[model samples]
Target: MFAAFDRPRISLRDAMAEALTKVPDVEIDPEGTFKYILVRVKDGDKQKDIVRGTKAAEYHNHIFDKVKPALEALGMECECLGGGKIEHNGKEKKIRVFGESTAFGKAEHSVSVEKLKTVFSNYEITWSDDKK
Candidate 1:
């Protein structure tokens, strides 16, 4: 009867496993292990809508136009990879931006399709990484 009333004991390892849930952007491999983690923010459908019109071009330009001065103030090295304006009906509209940066770069600039859906809170987002 007394033993039945005792609290269940949890090992430190078990406690850590449970605690990991509170941390975001963590990956556990098939073998259930990880060495490091990375976090990044990405554009979503809302971002696309914001970047797909002449108005968007102006807004995005205004946002990035501040970048050069900021970088200069910080004395950071940055480079533009390559990007260009997109046109739908033969008028300059929208801008696609890409860049290389020492401060932040990822070899696999990828987000799990499922993860993107969750982050954007839009189930319509879809992608596939499998090559068949």
Candidate 2:
């Protein structure tokens, strides 16, 4: 018989989903979060504002450290952009965190997607260039 220690480990995606519930102004999109990270890795230069508010920024900053090594292993470099501002519809909005990736391409993108699938196998991930 299998020991309790042999039980499956909880995935990072699931852990993130659970942690996200405490973050302010974030609609919990477990699948979308993975997709967003993948897209950031694929694009490699585009800066996407992920969330807003101080609590959200703090959350992203804290989580990025845990996620950085995984992206690096897939040949991508990522950073959390804090204290940034962007003009949206003639109003200056504070950007909680920006998602930016560097040094990744088609191969890395493919591999990253597969890795995410393995980590978040509970979701059916669809590839889309559109940032929704």
Question: What overall lDDT, based on C-alpha atoms, would model 1 receive against the true structure?
Answer: 0.28
Tens digit of per-residue lDDT, candidate 1, span 5-62: 5989897655644433333332222121111112322222111101111233233233
For 32-117, candidate 2 gives per-residue lDDT tens digits of 12212222332143232222222233333344554556556644454543222111211221111123333221122233335434
Clashing pairs in 1: none
Estimate the TM-score for candidate 2.
Answer: 0.25
The TM-scores, one per candidate, come to 0.31, 0.25
Each candidate: what lDDT?
A: 0.28, 0.34
Top TM-score: which candidate number?
A: 1
User: What's the count of clashing pairs in each model shown?
Assistant: 0, 0
